[model samples]
Target chain A: MKDKSIKMLKTIGLGFTEPLIRLFSGEEPAKNGKLFFKQALLPLLSIFLFIAIWYAGATALYNSEAEVRIEKARAEQGEEAALAMRKCIESGDVSCQPNTLPSPAQVYTAFKALWQDHLSISEKKADFKARVADTNSEREAQGLAPITYTGRPSFLDQIGTSLKTVAAGFLLAVFIAVPIGIVIGLSASLRTSFNWLIQIFKPVSPVVWLLLVFMIVKTVITDPSIDKSFIISSISVGLCAMWATLINTSMGVSTVDKDYINVAKVLKLSIGQNIFKIVLPASLPLIFTGLRITVSVAWMVLIAIELLAQSPGLGSFVWEEFQNGANDSNAKIIVAMFVIGIIGFLLDRIMLSVQNMMSFNKGIA
Target chain B: MAILELNNVSKSFGAGSSRIDVLTDINLSVREGEFLAIVGFSGSGKTTLINLINGLIFPDAGEVLLKGEPIAGPGPDRGVIFQNYSLLPWLSVYSNVKLAVDQVFPKMSSSEKEAHVLSYIEMVNLTPAKDKKPSELSGGMRQRVSVARALAMNPEILLMDEPLSALDALTRGSLQEEIIKIWSRDRKTAILITNDVDEGILMADRIIPMTPGPKATLGPEFKVPFERPRDVTNINKDAQYKRLRNDILEYLIEVGATRRQVSDQKYILPDLKPTMPGRVIFGRKKKKDKVKYF
Candidate 1:
């Protein structure tokens, strides 16, 4: 009994005194203290609560407006018209119905069905290729266009194409912009001479660039005959993305500390070493910011180009769905809108993660 | 033999109406392994003289020779420590020193170069903050890294331009001691541009005073007879140190007074505000009134 009491007393002593010991030792306390509350938990909790409030408020507003629209349509169309619309919907002729807006449940169902269709087609294609390889006659007769997967490419395939285009354009922009920007940043005379041209081109709309690019590709790139559509679209998107990197790089170089330049001079650092070691690293954070903005702009322009040019991309998929106006057309359009939004968000997040990694020396603040 | 020589060096700015002479027919020679300090008032062309030595700018007349050969441009052999701590802000202390060592000793192995830089950094007692950037280090620590960088180059002459004037008195004294210690080890030819008379007396083998400009020139060179490894605390007790310090202070005071008198005389409004109003302000004013018949 005495040993048990001693153990209990020690446990209670630690529960109370451990926090004080940790605080004095500069270790974070186990329980939340003023420092912990200010530094870690409070800000995180506040952000969480803010997001929750925003989601709830937006959902409520959407639901109320949707209900009002349904009621008004039913009242105006009369019971007979509503019955005809119900029959048309049951028969899968949704375009014949008066109301075009589908409920959220219908949209979700359509999205799942499309996803399943895409997966099934991909599986079918893979199985067909395997079977053809096993059979000598089938492989010899089929050629490039196999019969097993005869349907049009799915929405996911189109999205993949769109993403590839954006990647190619963004990479090309980076390659072209960095060297020129560094040169312009380093030399005052070059900057003055080139600045006017950059200013004139930066604000020119992507549509204008697209038209110009279309003409150039048609007239100049004649040998072997490139895909004019893809070339024009990618070039337009890349041009739109170029401005941000160039402007940001120049600004970054121009803002490098004067004392560092003096140090470079006194050390007699070579031109290449001075640029790569001193100027480039110093201007990294700003240049990365510019790169992020350029990527987002490229993504936006790529979609528009695909739609206008009838290129195989996510934008083309959306346009095709809108034109179809089938039973699942409205639902498919809503799903595509959400997918676009999510993809854009993911792209931005990736850029942010890369920026954070590059600037690790400068703490998160 | 003189390690460095300046012969009737002069510099001027602008041309025609805007032309102004900064330095005029100045001659000086720095002996081998000697520490020389040039002291002057603000805007007295001391910086211009140092720039000539460093080859950052050229003298309009005459030449500057390093070991009987003229300086073409800034080279690794003449390392300069600027008044402002010029450590590259993006570089850590170790890299800043290593950059110099790597350039000068390019044939050395990587490990050897690293060891060489770290030794100099440790010499300045900055080993603890070797990986910290200039922005993270204190002002004094940044200056210490600059010193380490210059020293790691192993230059024949170390040109310091008031390197400690920006630091607090205590930091300045500590750095001054560190510099003396470093100099005592190798005894490289050094020329310091400073305004502090005591700083000159404490560190230099000779203190040369510079007069003020539109046409500045070296006034006189005072030899310091104090022994090496001199203690700052006991420096005042040395009779020779005291006498040299007093002489430099006296000369500086005379230059200061002369400059003030010249300034006052130059800005004096001529009696051209006609004592007899419409007396025709013609080609030139009469010298009789300006002469002041006292």
Candidate 2:
């Protein structure tokens, strides 16, 4: 059973815990302890070292900026004005606080602040929903639209919005790429003819895709009720990230074993059966590889697309925090940066797990 | 009456300057319930010949006739067991067999189809591995799955293209016997293409040698007069088996030697010797009587 669990852990790419698990099970404690230190404790120590470096850097920058502010005050006015400026800065006044790099403590405070803000917004939303329930029912009876909160989304809501947008874009990419990939893959002529088009479009920037999508979506979706930004953001994300899956799928399909095709021919299977039973299964490993890359690409480009489109997502939240330039704005931006990175990492892990599950060749995945 | 026939069939690849003939004038016929073995050197177009009869590729010149009817393309009537096992790696042994059974016997009820697939798997002694994928199976086990899949199709003629060549000797020996046992139960017109002369003689009713290629063709056929259930141990001791094995080996060797001599005369290689440097550098002393033959 222990061996099985170790195998399962290795399969999921979390083999680092093996030594710790072995150590806990009392199997060669001396050796396992050394391995556990190398694998686990060392990484934990490195993380602390990184945080220390960041904290020191932030403090140095803040002090330098504060010193420059005091010097400017003394140069412009008298010593009393410089003293007042120093006092204000020292008291952490919003007006005179340095807007440079924020320290770890400030980031932690900002995280707590964001959580509190989310809780307050949640309560207000619930209260609004309850208050509008009767009016919404009446409006439904009269065939009219109900009232909405029309309030600013909290940080967590932005993350939720980002997740939803990425999910939609990824689905769009799969829907557009896989069938086209298969069709192009089956015919060498089609693959050759379309090669130029894929090469040309694959490297186009996300911002350009967003503009292109916006131009089409603005004219096509002129309805006032529909959220054009969301549509434009998702479509741009899909277009920007779909190249990997398309190329991989086509290559995968074209490279299916000749023996499998021969077997299909001898079995006299129809075209549909030939593809589904033999071709698809043979190409699944490559297709999943493409999908894993597509998902990571989708997540990487989603922020830039969302920011440009002004969608209520993490990208827009980061932009808004940067533009706000309040006392804790830099800290909040740092928080958003970490959030985005952690989310991207989690998305990749999820894709890898799904790829492993779907693939037939366990070693390749 | 012949169950499968090749009439003046010819096949080639490429065109213009690179054109090369692979098989030429391949005329043969397999009578109903006869096991015919075609043995040849590797790359002598044995696979091309089998593919012609299976209708995988059309003959450039003549026609391949099955039951006096010309074949259109590959069909379930000629079940081909590929040289590479060709069991779908993603599918279990059961599914691999069921796929062929489903396509050939679409009208068979679900339960009937299940039983049919299982029976073929059982015939190949692979019932325990029915649920395992080809990737999980050993090379021999994978070939068994391939055999079961082909057999489940219930083809009128079984076309095996070096099916057991990838297996080890012991596995090949056992599978050869198993195939014979299965074939003898309800005799099927089968064609076995192989490079091993002994294998052909052991399994086939009539052994035919394919001469060495650029344009390989079949030689005279030798009839195997052994009775039902030929014992492998006793066959080695039999006088007839030795004569047949020797005759086939001698004919193959003679043809190979003549082909090599004819080709040898065509190419006159240039004879030039490389000249070595005069002295060996970085040495304590050069040998006084050293031969500089480069």
TM-score of chain A of each: 0.73, 0.95
Candidate 2 pairs with clashing backbones: none
Q: All candidates' lDDT scores?
A: 0.82, 0.90
Error of 1 at A306 (Å): 2.2
What's model 1's lDDT at B26?
93
After superposing candidate 2 on the true structure, give the runs of residues whose Cα lies further than 4 Å from its correct spot: A1-13, A27-35, A70-94, A363-365, B264-294
lDDT of 1: 0.82
The iRMS of the candidates, in order, is 4.0, 2.3
lDDT of candidate 1 over A4-82, digit per residue (tens): 5434433333233333444666665555366555545667899789656755655566456545544655799877765
Instruction: Tell me the docking grade of candidate 2.
Output: medium
